[model samples]
Target chain A: MKKILLLAGTALALAAGTMTASAQEKLKACWVYVGPIGDFGYSYQHDQGRLQVEKELGDKVETAYLENVSEGPDAERAIERFAREGCKIVFTTSFGFMDPTIKVAKKYPDVKFEHATGFKKADNVAIYNARFYEGRYVIGQIAAKESKAGLAGYIVSFPIPEVVMGINAFMLGAQSVNPDFKVKIVWVNTWFDPGKEADAAKALFDQGADIIVQHTDSTAPLQIAEERGLKGFGQSSDMIKFAPKAQMTSIVDDWGPYYVKRVQAMLDGTWSSTDTWEGMKEGAVVLPPFANMSDETKKLAEETYAKIKSGEFHPFTGPIFDQAGAEKYPAGAVVPDGDLLGMLWYVKGVDDKLPQ
Target chain B: MLEAIILTVITAATPLLLAAIGELVVERSGVLNLGVEGMMVMGAVAGFAITVSTGSPLLGIVAGLVAGLAVSLIFGFVTLTLVANQVASGLALTLFGLGLSGLLGEGFVGTPGIKLPSLSIPGLTDIPYVGRILFGQDILVYVSFALVLAVSWFLFRTRGGLVLRAVGDNHVSAHALGYKVIRVRYLAVMFGGACAGLGGAYLSIAYTPLWVENMTAGRGWIALALVVFSSWLPSRLVIGAYLFGAVTILQLHAQPLGLGVPSQFLSMLPYLATVVVLVAISGNRRATRFNTPACLGAPFVPDR
Candidate 1:
């Protein structure tokens, strides 16, 4: 059954490819969002990138988008719809869309599919993600400097490597400043839910965490921190407006440059399936203006940011230990991209368990 | 620290209590409306939109309640007049609500909302621990408590309550006795809708104070389950809501408190508690049968 299905899929893909090849029009690109485009978080950032592509590429390429596409079989339909609508390139902007994107790509071999924060790739599928951990490291330094309670809070979304790495990087960053610095992790197991995220922030605060960080994509945690007169950082987008005085700084995902670059590659006939993970150096991740911190802390954050941007430092450098006190990376050894992309265990100072 | 935990627990529980209390009344009137989740999300989006436009959290809450009531009317009309399957109609209502709320709330996304301020009774609010818990809560918290009392009194202490109960226990007999069974059920469903709307508005206006797609999440379903877990009792509904809320809040703090369990099990605490408590409560067949509306989910044709 599998072999027959594969052959049938290949035949259908070939048919679709020839049909697309027959049409000689402007390149049509499409984007699928897991949340509404107005979420002001992950999806919103992706939409911004889409707009940037249109602005930079001009009439050479036309773009379209479908927001709030749930991940699963539903995502497969959304991606396929873009293909049927003559979208040469479709960007699935969520980790949960990985399998669906790959499946859709298999049936539309001529169409290029780019998935964000995902690991899987096909002949026509590309994977791209920002090294958000790089930004997390910088914020960790600021948290260490400003936190009077010495303990920080991390409101986590899932046990996935992407979220786990952010938690580890944040703790490592804090530990770099104060070796005895501790972090408390509260896993809400959801990517977006304002109420749950706010409650998690309160729970962390009640447990003596003066500074809060979140891997989830809502500004609720930051808002709660602001209301409680505490300090925290934002996720995905710059959320200084939401929490003003409470936000130390936000780790903003700047995907506009990367989006434009990829479309340019497609237009130039140089597009190919590749894994792209870019950080501050590549302008993929940016930290908004530092605020609500002392001048001394600001200088330290600026110095760290500059170093990361200049490739002078990597967040996962050397001598790392799991929560069980087991050495995962030896002294002076930097963690490989594959390891960072698939991180599963917590760092030594994270007061939480990694669910299997 | 304890105060902060208590505050969060109250915030989490209030929405569940509000939605469950309304559902409890509906179920008592023999209408199995599974559309609480749908009504709640509709309320959430409408509430957020109104609050954003009018700059008044109070008006936003009212809009949410109206939105929920409006959606419930569709379910009531279909099941009551058309004599449709209550279960199927309820499920359709949920799907409709989720989709429409997403469309309705499209433009309101990412906008910062004004939080409903807590009631500060001056001197009483200044009394440290006692003051903050009792007096520092928002107006909705007090309203929820009053609802529990009002519903309790209305259900067990009034002539109207007996008639509604009779209609639920045996609709055919009630209809024969000229009790207007369908009318009674419709009123109960609308009340349930109003409460759910208020719960959803509270979520968007006070709890998180922001609008996001699917902001109500699965709290409406949880509220529905809470109705059953309370064995259709108004007072027990409060206990169930708080227990669920406490478990949800504590699951996050479990690791910080150094419980040697895996975070996955801790994360499942609320759901696990729900299942365990539900099974235990439902184990008593006599008690279960006595509390449950005998004609629940059954189509009632007054003419027949």
Candidate 2:
């Protein structure tokens, strides 16, 4: 009887140990940055976020990344490589990685895919991006408060919704302060050629634009702003180095906590494939590191930040009118996630002069 | 305006200056080295990778030259040794170089690059408008100019230059004279590779101060055009390169002035100028033949 009882206890202990060991297995997480994480801006900030995951969840998580991964096939192959390496979770850090990521997610249902700056949804693939348009609105207000030409120059990459939304938001924000403010657009047909971006910025400035903002990556436009002595808001990351005096501020992307949270969710078995659109409230999007503003400008930014955080002020509030004088948003109806994320139109306060 | 123009020309001309001079030597030896673009791109990646690794500007240049030479040798084997069609092989070389650069420069994209240091000769550098424009440039710019002069003198005045030209004009005749036509051509091809590599190195290291995918931004083609546009003459390359450079830089200035011209049109100015110059220089076929090598594209077959 005693021998049988001891054997039963050993069997129970073995099962318990096995369960504990499996529970402690570190979750495999991987990331693919569209550009090198050290670019001092967009990609760099994203990389910083990935690093944050490692930092926040030391032994519980292991992270890997392939920097400078191209948007097309290169991204697909990298994701496959990551999934094959036992990664339970993968983050595709660009808008272009949407479909490719979704396709990959379908093949590997066990692994989760999180795509940044995209809207595609799937059972295993979740999309997420910062609400950058909100910050642009705040900076636009600062630009109007600072400059008199009441002309805002935009250095744009494509006619994509992401770029368009920023332009419209900036126009609305600036117009709120300066009703006569007009936003001019220049599409240089590239994402990150500083020389071209700077040249575009200069052209806009020469056309009587005293304030500048860019959708393109790189500090080139800010460099031009410094040279021309114009006020400007940064793109992707705060580029104060490019234009210390001229840089009003930028919308900072805090991807670290987001990465860490998703990793934790995987650990807790609560990880789901859900699109996440978080802004200042979730600490996903941060105001430029710190604005270099006049006292009045600082006050305006602080109040805007507080209002935005409390959900009292929405940048795309009701009674919004399109460039063609169309009533896009009804009274008391704020812009929805669908239209805002894929926005390809301008607001009433802004001009509709696109480049030929 | 002239200073800006001159500044633009030098910047634009360096890559072409490097590639054309390299091609000019190959042509002089009856070898049509169409691998200039490939060699330049290899040099670009090699130079960028080395600079990224070592952070030394000089070592980066040496690495670029070796990269260019290695790429050219691949072309040399296929064309010179195999006696393959020069035009097709050169195009292949370009395709290979571009792909190779994209692969290698993947990690370098969006990364801050090593900026080539400039030499400020106090008196010349501070000469009012010219100071920042000319004197503020790095040593490579000066080297490019020097290379042009050195090449001009070599082609027009030196015995070795004459022998190489003889080989290019007609390797059969030169080979009969016991000039070792094959050996001379080999050296010229290597020289072209080295220069093209240096040009690419300049693009990655000095001018942009950053690396992006396909960042040479069609400068390789411009260098090829510079050779023909200059009628394969060294001095004329300087003039052509600077003019192209001026157009590139002026657009940067013009767009800001918000001139009535569309931004896309302004951006296309440099390429447009290249087309115009190419057409203007290649005006008379007969006149071009006088300077162009007669058996330029023909393979050398001693036994045949």
> How large a fraction of the reference contact set does each model reproduce?
0.67, 0.08
Superposed model 1: Cα runs more than 4 Å off:
A1-24, A319-332
Segments of candidate 2 deviating more than 4 angstroms: A1-26, A73-75, A148-152, A182-184, A201-211, A227-231, A242-246, A325-327, A330-332, A348-352, B1-153, B156-158, B167-176, B180-218, B225-304
Looking at chain B only, the TM-scores across the models are 0.97, 0.91
Q: Report the C-alpha lDDT of model 1 over A1-356, residue by residue, as the tens digit.
A: 01111111231221111112122378988888887776788888998998898788856887777776777777787789888888999999988899999888999999999999999989999999999999999898899889999999888877889888888888888899999998887778888888889988988888889999999899999999999999999999998878888999998999999999999999999999999999999999999999999999999999999999999988899899988899989998999999988889888988766767
CA lDDT, every prediction? Answer: 0.87, 0.76
Docking class of 1: acceptable
How well is each residue in B84-138 modelled by candidate 1, as lDDT tens digits?
A: 9999899889877876786688778777888998999999998989899999999
Instruction: Tell me how far the alpha carbon of residue B60 in candidate 2 is from the true structure, in angstroms, after superposition.
Output: 9.1
Worst 10 residues of 2 chain A by lDDT: A12-21
